[model samples]
Target chain A: MNEYYNSAYKPLLAIDCVIFGYEQGELKVLLTRRKQDPYKGAWGLATGFLHFGESLHYAAERVLKKQTGLDRIYMDQLSTFGEVDRDPEARVISLVYYALIKVESQTLETLEKNQAQWFSITALPKLMFDHETMIQMSWGKLRRKSRYQPIGFELLPEKFTLPELQSLYEAIHQKQFDKRNFRKKILATGLLKKLDEKQKGVSKKGAYYYVFEEGKYDELISQGFNFELKSMAFGS
Target chain B: MNEYYNSAYKPLLAIDCVIFGYEQGELKVLLTRRKQDPYKGAWGLATGFLHFGESLHYAAERVLKKQTGLDRIYMDQLSTFGEVDRDPEARVISLVYYALIKVESQTLETLEKNQAQWFSITALPKLMFDHETMIQMSWGKLRRKSRYQPIGFELLPEKFTLPELQSLYEAIHQKQFDKRNFRKKILATGLLKKLDEKQKGVSKKGAYYYVFEEGKYDELISQGFNFELKSMAFGS
Candidate 1:
């Protein structure tokens, strides 16, 4: 709306979100069918053009809400993609962001109305434009961040069993962790609070649910402690 | 320039480089004095507008070469700054990049010709626009990245003493590390090639000079090894 610079070249600005969600012990990404030409009906990351006078993060949040009908999810800027001809119809420079959402938060009816679906990272469909590249980069960010930060918790429910937490890590990293070793390393951080309540129907001996203690995690980080679970024994 | 999308709004695109260099046991950043009216004479990161059809990395490289007269340096995209009022003269979106260069590689004559100077991170001048925020963000990124990657080598000479390497890490992280512990952890990685030569200037007992084994570092990284130096004791 503001023509602040009349003579400078302006490239079209846009934002694309790689929204990750975990369900049934698998990591999945939310995608929407393109409604316009240039790739009509093709699946792609949830994306939208940036509105004038809006911050980049706000644009990403708006796009995520528009596509998934969910708000207040954990989101991070992955990187910016400006490959000149990345868009077939225009020279649109896009800022790619990754979001982690709880799968149960979105209703099936909303997803149907928006023509949105979740695809496992390993089995993604042919995406329009350079979206496949964006998804791959987002997956790398998630895997790297999950090792040092409790970012995987965003994909799981607030209260989760140790097994569920380990499953989420395995899904992101694409490698199974030794069950006993995983629990030991994670619990040793003293960042998880074990709830007296137990998860039902997951196992015959229901595993006790746990919640991440964000305050304690931050405090530990301030005191020169890093959260690293990468050394846990890897399973074949 | 190709006018592919005449109807869409195009924000001005630009790239800014936070070029970091190390010299005499201190870390410094390359800065230029603005020549135009918006922030004339103010110190800021070297930056330039993106040319039509130029990729983001190319534009950043061009800017780096132009300001510091250095090419093919180790650079990475720090982040994009798209705040609506980030630039007072125009609605410009900046893709900020951080570059690590060996200080001795640049000539003083070239720096004088470009009116660029290196400033210590601890004592930076008043920068124009939101360049200060960009520098702060870049420092955080450098610190975080230095912990998990062997990026500190980018700021050091090809053959460096163990104390020089430790000093570079100390400057970036703003903390002191235990001498014995730091040397043990770094040596155990086997990514440093201990040279047969010794450096005699700074200490009564000359220290051994070493060079980073980049090939081995990459090989180890490909095999799922992380380069971590955070475990060394930190000082108050």
Candidate 2:
């Protein structure tokens, strides 16, 4: 029995995360430089081998916390990468996860110590192995999800100006939307609460700050109200 | 080195398929009864252990073929289920996949020999080992994907009527769409070819037959056309 069990084929299970954060009208992905061999010193998605008796989600969260020093981040399993040669070291099946992290909420010291850095999605560095493909797939999923879900809220501060929200959407979809149309459609959803205070700086006429009303959003979702934004062309 | 490798912890990897088919105005999922000791004689998703050095997608396809005698089906990796106690027998991590197959295209002999059967999505049996959760998650993903992609076409016959297409959508979303609006919206996309044929069996006044034009759909998709049907309420 021991010999039979030992002879059975076993492949290493792993997890990789595409950590996305939005800031300054740009979409960024957090990446870490490989500190070990095979692709040492090369940038890649934060990844680790899944341990025994652990759930995939738990393993993903562990990797996220260990790499970014962020806990309770919003993450979803993007897809599994099981190409024959995805990892050169051994037969490794990677369950890739995409995480949305508020850029301001992360600790900079942890990133600096681990040689972790955020790069613009448009100008990503050469990633080791199939990490680049994972990032591209995550970006595609994010763009599609953002159209129907208010996932952009995960990447923003607790309270943000209307322009900041709009910029985040524009950065995500990689296109400009009509201001009036965008505001009218988004406001109709009733998922944002206009705060009493106005955001100072960045404009002579400060824009009003708005907070995402999770309770209202959940209520609307329960009632089957879908969130959709028209895919307006550039300069629309 | 061999002793060390053999002594290391290893978890069993498995693949489960949510095989979806549309027939008789209903969405159906293919299931099989477990023949082995664990959950013996209980209905569950068609599943198999993943072999060493095999890709996850390949494992899913192999399971589909072994259980249904189907090949080259439209399948997508839904997500990985890796809860520690998901499988009571062992530490099993299941990679779940959803497959779309035309009911008529399948070989029924293999299904009968394997004791595999199709159950309506609305009325499923007590599935074994977290299989119910897998089916529900796959259904959710299918409904969402069908909204923006012509995925339901995979479940229908090559030549179908307008009403048939409408029924497929209704069955998937579990709601009725406005006939006029659904037809108008679907036709405007130019993804269906109206054939000179008519389907007379379903109604006295036969509906005109239409075929999904895959090439046209692909072209439209490349040109940034999104497939969407308004989620009309029931009895609309």
Candidate 3:
């Protein structure tokens, strides 16, 4: 083993999170104002350097918790960004992670203190560095992953109505869907269990709530199932 | 600008290319023996440090060209691997890019000089660091991406038969697809233009050769047409 080659070619590693949440009828991303320079005060994705004695997931989770005070949130690795001067200050490489969390979760207050804000996808501000591009890529990823995977459920409350579910898909998809067709396709998948309860907040004809039937979806997916919603019939 | 908060941190960034090709009815990944140490002689993904002023895509192309003497390949960013000690030699953050190329296009002489070899996914040897895991992840990515994207075409010859196309999918999917439905769904996408010519190498009942309708696919994709291969009639 050449010790010189081992020691000489050290590369820096960091992780950045593209935290997403749905609230107020729009798709929004969680971002923070950088408190440091080179790009100090510029709004960027919630990110940090990887620490010793931790896995990449743990490090990302730590950054999420520290920045948002949210624990056990839905997070997944997105990609790694490593252009040599992507950081300008150095050869910093970022392992980007994407997260979808309930908007009403308790983490909002902590994020507020840290200058974290949620910007609607259609109305995003100019972000620092390549963060805007990161968000855009994350959106494309979310749209793709949400279809085959049961991740759309992550954007909704544990108990949600059919209309709410459709809207969640609409927001993520950025297109309208026919209610009946959407319901038919979703129910046909056998991945949503209709609860005996109704949503009390909005109606005389109250909408029934449902929870994800994860087991059935998993079984079907193992048998090679694809969840597709892109169609003229669904009002795309 | 609070320089104090950011002045101390500088990091290194590296790029790892997950170059994949199809040959002998199997999907293979390009692996190189680490010439320099830390893990000298250990097998790893064909990777290199990102140089200044080059884009990520350029870096990926450079890595591929250096190893295979191949250019203009179908490549995209897969994900970043940023475990703190993912590189035991350094805090290197690796942005993993995946490339799909025709197995026959890359000459063996170039790879021999570069000490790189293509290994079947199923028969891979022990790799350094997280490369084995990276390769597995890239395989999953290929499976997923190939299902909805026109990427499998990258692994096929410029012109190929329906059987050849199906074989490529099966190699990546590792499953038997119903031939009738597979052909129907793929042809229906309008991304494969049937040539008048037939491949007469195997049988008298020659199969028609088809070329990837790249121009049409690109135009349609821009106009929001999706390419997917899931079918209800596929296995039923």
lDDT of 2 by residue, A169-213 (tens): 899988888888788877877889999998887789899999999
lDDT of 3 at A24: 59
Please provide, for model 2 over B129-194, each residue's C-alpha lDDT reduced to its tens digit, 9 standing for 90 to 100: 999999999999998888778898999998888888889988998988889988887887678999
Better of 1 and 2 by DockQ: 1
Please provide, for model 1 over A116-226, each residue's C-alpha lDDT reduced to its tens digit, 9 standing for 90 to 100: 998999999999999999999999988888877888888888899999999888888888888888998999889999999988886799999999998998898898677
Q: Rank the candidates by lDDT, best first.
A: 1, 2, 3
- Per residue, candidate 3 scores C-alpha lDDT tens digits across A1-236 of 24543433444567788988887568888888988778789989988877656667898999888877878988888777766667776666667889988777736566678898888988898888788888998999898777767788887878999899888888888888877788888787778899999988698899999999878878888887766554522363
List clashing residue pairs in candidate 3.
A11-B91, A12-B12, A79-B80, A80-B80
With candidate 1 superimposed using the best TM-score fit, by how many Å does residue B40's alpha carbon deviate from the native? 0.9
User: lDDT for every model?
Assistant: 0.86, 0.85, 0.79
Q: Which whole-number lDDT from 0 to 100 does residue B185 have in model 1?
A: 88
Q: Write the per-residue lDDT of candidate 3 for residues B11-87, one digit (tens) a residue.
A: 45567888899986899988889887787899988888766566667888998888778878788887776666677
CAPRI verdict (incorrect, acceptable, medium, high) for model 2: acceptable
Q: Tell me the deviation in Å of residue B125 in model 3.
A: 2.9
**Residue A88 CA displacement from its true place in model 1, Å:** 1.5
